[model samples]
Target: MESLSTKSQLDMARNVHDMGSINKMREAIASGDETVLQEAAQQFEAIFVQMMLKSMRKAQDALADENSPFNSQQVKFYRDMHDQQLATDLTSGGGLGLADVIVKQLGQTEDSYTPASVIRSDGDLSSLNRNRVYNVAEAQDIALSSQSIRSPSAQKD
Candidate 1:
């Protein structure tokens, strides 16, 4: 079973999707303060976008460096995923553009990209709670194995 820490991180990442809705939910559950909810929502959205951009940049840099062992094939996967992530960001209430750098580095065109399938396909939050956001921290064989890109490259961080 995945640990609670991992689950919590995944929840945070998934929650990054609907900042407004999340704030409303939090406010409704707390005391129905729309202003507090709005502020909280903005904060969450900002933090989420910041984190995503940072992660995307780091991943793109790591992948692009030939010595990093990310390799061309792995870079391709990460690139595609990053592109999808960028598309999703366009629909997000908070506008961020970190994915643009990653997409450019990957040599992807705007037309070739697609939006986030997970968010688009999934329904409401309570009904659509996702599994853990997979990360290298949880991988047991990263150092033990030869694969440099051990986890799914499609993942942001």
Candidate 2:
């Protein structure tokens, strides 16, 4: 039973690690926050493009000799960095337009919204309820009082 539980826990951990970014993107899209959703979509597109680049590199024949001075671990690391930067630049500069399509399909266009700065003034808690705002001291006092009320020792005293 213990071994089964441990195996299940390991599987859960691996699934969480693999789906972390995807979960974040889903959350952003579901949050109704246009800016965050758009940014997440763009980043996802960038990652997709980077994966494509890596695959393409793997498919290509190595033109450089193994004994060449330019062929080293550092060179490979720098090449990966270059590929990452290229992916970022391509996405930012409207590379494949995948992000744009995603944003459009999600119906989060810039035309349908106003900036928050223009809508709300400073010190605006009008939308928030009273229960949402409380001091830490007040919370601690409430907790202490609740514990005292619930304790059998307090009742006996």
Candidate 3:
């Protein structure tokens, strides 16, 4: 029974067609694999697209006539399959760039990355003073003092 559940979880994570499943993220992270991470991110993006399409279909169905042939169960099943494939194709073709963003955020090395729970659990939060900024003026002054500058890189001509 336990093995069956575990196998299902693995299948959910590995199957690109199962856009709604995201149960194996912990496994992917534990494996410490970039390709796995990339695949997971892509799958996440595909899931997002699928959800959007599902919602759009629901909205479209709201005004749909029940007596219409287009509203048949077989038609809906085929339509859903089409949407799933469309989502997968869109993700593979660079998608909405959500996968790239996910990869960028989570692909950091252990040394450079610290989980939020660890920081709070350590109880070394003397740095986060409550009265650090009492007023808007003080906050503005502090923000101005340590303003971060960003340099935009122009593409090569």
Worst 10 residues of 2 by lDDT: 8-17
lDDT of 2 by residue, 68-153 (tens): 76677788788777887677667765769898888777765578767888887776565453445656567877988785557777
Off by over 4 Å in 2: 1-32, 108-157
Which runs in model 1 stand beyond 4 Å of their true positions?
1-33, 64-157
**Residue 102 lDDT (model 2):** 84
Model 3 C-alpha lDDT per residue in residues 1-157, reported as the tens digit of each score: 6445644565455545654455365654465534666777787898899999999999999999999999999999999989987887788768999999999898887888988986675654354453553565687877766636223342232
Top candidate when judged by lDDT against the true structure: 3
Mark the 10 consecutive residues where model 1 has the least summed lDDT: 127-136
* Winning candidate number (TM-score): 3
lDDT, candidate 3, equals 0.74
lDDT preference between candidates 1 and 2, better one: 2
- Candidate 1 lDDT over residue span 28-62, tens digit each: 44653323333344444555665666677667677
- How do all models score by TM-score? 0.23, 0.45, 0.56
